[model samples]
Target: MQQSNAYIIIFSVILTVVLGLLLSGTSEVLKPIQKKAEELDTKKQILGAVVPAEQISRMKAEEINQFYESRIASKVVNIAGEEVEEQDGVQVTAENIDVAKNYKKAPEDRLYPVFIFHEEGNEEAANAYIFPVYGSGLWDNIWGYLALQTDMATIEGITFSHAGETPGLGARITSPEVQQRYKEKSIYSESGELVSVVMQKGEGKDYSGEPHKVDGLSGATITAEGVNKMLKNYLEHYQSYMERKKEGTPKMALN
Candidate 1:
């Protein structure tokens, strides 16, 4: 008792529609959870720029969120360093702006996010400023957060992440050992030029005396170059904001 072609066609259509609806419903159900997870991860990465990785890793997701809410405050700015309250009718926020998408636009057309880490209970007094940077790596995109000390010139801590890169070579950028090398490094020269820190040509060289250079990844020169360019580009983008803050004339208050 074989089914008719019309019956088979009708069954197929019904099956397809049902499957599609099921998938759509499942996606809708999971969307919020996925978003929460991404938000949590982003907070962890931002915190990674200032807090120790081991410390962050030790905490639970709820703890991470609580800590971020209590200590971090953010603002959005443009290339000219003016505070941006809204853009194209949408309220701008440091957490909402996507750095990777902004990287695709012309520098002057992009919005930058500044995450300020304040004292435990005092939001008015900033301890460090964190900025996100994005660039191309050998295989794919690379990005990171750089936290500058209160002076806005010296690096407090740094954290790097990649979309895709060699496991042990270029991927080393995310390693604590590599990032630790950038701590205390200055992004400015003695003459006050914003000569952002450079990842020199090779690893194991003495850059201890060089205020603006760090050891390159062992076998990842291209990735190192990517990191170098990302830092210089984003640092320049944020320079005006830093200068304004340093001179005590920031367009917006820390709170």
Candidate 2:
């Protein structure tokens, strides 16, 4: 019995060491692939919101990189629309930016990244804000930016995508139709009332009183509900930002 017990203890220790080494080795081997995939996926998501998928699909990776670098500056801006202050002052360059694992829980030294999607020399430049939007979806989360029209309410161009939504159902939130709906719809009224986006079960009515309410998906009721909630929350989250942007001209430098 003693001999058997001793053998068992020895075998357990050996097994633990072998399993630890194997796991460590496996993690090291897959680290590069994992990192590359994450970077690629992040680029794809950001690009999807920056340019239409069709536009990106037609271009090569290098083209995408070039176009991305030229039009959009991947910089971090605070919710207040200020250049995120860093160890120096406000960070206008990415080099001065501090990196973080998660934007929601970024370190005190790090600025939450809000990629500026801009069109250079465009007349609409006057209206641009460091437009940032984020929200929780059914399965995970969804977020994006809006290079909205100068009116502070009208959407000029929008790029959106989501994360971990059920494949066909909840995933439709990323559809072009969903993304573009904001273009024709009004998020605010002329009376200065704040109107949040909504998703309905049946065909929605006219735009004046019903611009926000979209048709909720048939099967994925929960996802539809999530979309509605996400839009409402994220829009509210960026209320201060939208209020700070210009309506007509490049409103005399930001206060």
Candidate 2's clash total is 1
Candidate 2 Cα deviation (angstroms), residue 162: 4.6
TM-score of each: 0.90, 0.69
Compared with the true structure, what per-residue lDDT tens digits does model 1 show for residues 1-255? 459998999999999999999999999999999999999999999999999999999999999999999999999999999999999998988999999999999999999999999988788788899999899888999999999998889999999999998999999999999999999999999899999999988789989998899999878999999999999999999999999888873533543
Clashes of each: 0, 1
TM-score of 1: 0.90
Give the top-scoring candidate (lDDT): 1
Global CA lDDT of candidate 2, please? Answer: 0.59
Per-residue alpha-carbon lDDT of model 2 for 67-92, expressed as tens digits? 65666655454555455546365335
lDDT per model vs. reference: 0.93, 0.59
lDDT of 2 at 222: 74
